[model samples]
Target: MEYISFYNGNEMPIVGLGTFRVENNDECKASVKHAIESGFTHIDTAMIYENEDKVGEGIAEGLAATGLKRSDLFITSKLWLADYGRENVAEAYETSLKKLGLDYLDLYLMHWPGTDEAVMIDTWQGMEDLYKENKVKNIGVSNFNVEHLEALLAQVSIKPVINQVEFHPYLLQASLNRYLDVQNIHMESWSPLMNAQILEDETVKAIAKEVGKSPAQVIIRWNIEHGVVVIPKSVTPSRIEENLEVFDFSLTAEQIERLDKLNENSRIGPDPVEYSGH
Candidate 1:
């Protein structure tokens, strides 16, 4: 498993399993358990998904099944929009921790920027308190653009360790990534697989043929090579394992250029331009 060292010196897996729509308790538990069994140590979930408890059950079963310790896995959860204020954030984070049944979260992030600046600042303060109290190892933000990042940067003492967004071949986000790179802030991809359409993309397929790898592997490898932490979710066991089979090969400069041309500046989720934070 490849890793990316954060600005604070903590190591994060380059690839992780995303549990966004894995709501069914049995299915979620099985998917995570299968992932762990297949050597995946990182798990991503959020309170907005309302599946943290099920995720916890899966993690517990996976640990028991594999005999892996808590420190071996990178477990991340996010605070929802409804719990955006300072007071509410503190309580909400505690609730998530309890539901996850973990002593300390590996990483906790603001699910969204939210509509209130004061609330966002307060939430960061709460995260700072949690870090000081040894409740969370790192703190970050999600779905925040450059402006939002600037806003958070101006007020917080501890800079956000990461910013996760919906990134894929269609939405390249090169400019945003450059800005984040300047700040030494790591970027994570939520929908890294882009609904598996890369498999059907002519450019990606061409690269796959040239590289003797699948298109899925090519795009995923591109993400890792570009230094982005990606979580490509899959309920199928074969797809889950195939997603991790990207470590052995590398993409050529020309192939990367071709793939870069595939970006359409499209977003599968909410538009950040009109986004009033959340």
Candidate 2:
């Protein structure tokens, strides 16, 4: 698996399994197991997903099935909005650890920027505490815009290593990407396939035909070529295996540009700024 090194020198697989709405415990566990058995070493889950327990089960089974140890895997989870506070964030981290049946996480993130700036800053402080205590290897924020990042960076001592967000050909987020680049923050793409919407796009289809790859593979290759970590979710065994097969061929610069022009600032998930769910 290809890896991206964080600012602190920690590295993770460029591709991972995203567990967003895989809510059924049995299904979630089986999907994770299948992904691991198919050569996935990275797994992404969040407290809000409410599937950590099952994800943990899949990790245990996958380790046993593959004879791989826990240290060989890169596991990540997030702190939900409801857990935003100096004290509650740490507790939330512990709760995720317990649920995932792990001693420490490879990376942990604030799920969102919250409703205002003070809450985000306070929550970031809590994340900093986790980093200092060695509870997690790296810390970051998800769904943060440039404004939120600037405000957090102005107040915090340590910079976030990543800013996970919804990204795809449809939602290019070019300006945000540029800002993240200047800040030395890596971007991780969730919904990289636009929840299957991009698979049927004419441009994507033509590229897939030209490259002799699936449209999904073309989109994933685009993210990797642009230096973004991508986690595409799937529960089917065949698709779980297929998603990891983008290393063979690459998109040419011309092809990449065509894919780039497909951007319309579209989003398949909720907008972070307006989302008020706890």
Candidate 3:
């Protein structure tokens, strides 16, 4: 698996397993376990997902199956929008820790900017405190645009190391990438396959055929090659393995350019800036 070294001194796997709508307990646990067994060390979860306990259970099962220690994995979780605020941030972090049954998280992110301004700043400060306390290795924001990032950077003592956004071939954010690159903030992509939209594109399909790889694999490979971290969710065991099978081949510049033409500025997930009114 490819990796991105965040500015905050942590390395995140380029490809992780996203657990957004994976609601079933047994299936989520089994899929997470299968993903870990399939060479996925990065497991992304959220407090709002209401599956941290199951995610923890799956991780334990995977560790038992593989005999790997906690240090061998990079786990990430997000604080929900409703839980944003200084005091609640601490409470949320503790709650997530209790649910995950872990001493520390590899990374913790703000699920959204949240509604309350004081609460947002408070939560950010709390996250900074958590970082200083070494409760979390790194802190970040999700669904944040350039303006939102700039605003946070202006106020907070600790800058977010990464920004997880809804990036994919169909929703290419060149401007966002350029800005984040200038700030040395790494970008993580959610809904990486563009909700399987790229799979239906003629150019992507042709390229996938030429490369002897599936369309999903090609899109993921493209994202990694472009230095964007991605998390593709799947409950099927076979697809989980397939998602991890992207490291074998490299996308050529010409192929990447061809795929770049597929961008229509389509976003498969919520827009962070508008959603949070930031």
lDDT of 3 by residue, 73-189 (tens): 999999887777677777899899888878889999998875555667778898998999888899998887777777788888988888888888788899999999999999998
lDDT of each: 0.87, 0.93, 0.87
Return the top candidate by lDDT.
2
TM-score top scorer: 2
Candidate 3 residue runs with Cα over 4 Å from true position: 115-118, 276-278
Q: What TM-score quantifies how close candidate 3 is to the native fold?
A: 0.96
- Show model 1 residue runs off by greater than 4 Å: 273-278
Please give the clash total of every predicted structure, in order: 0, 0, 1
TM-score of each prediction: 0.96, 0.98, 0.96
lDDT tens digits by residue: candidate 2, 1-278: 89999889999899999999899479999999999999999999999999999999999999999999999999999998888888898899999999999999999999888778888898899999999998889999899999899899999998999999999998899999999999889999999988888899999999999999999999999999999999999999999999999999999999999999988998888898887664
lDDT of 2 at 66: 99
Which candidate, 1 or 2, would have the higher TM-score against the true structure?
A: 2
The predicted structure with the larger lDDT, 2 or 3, is 2
Candidate 2's C-alpha lDDT? 0.93
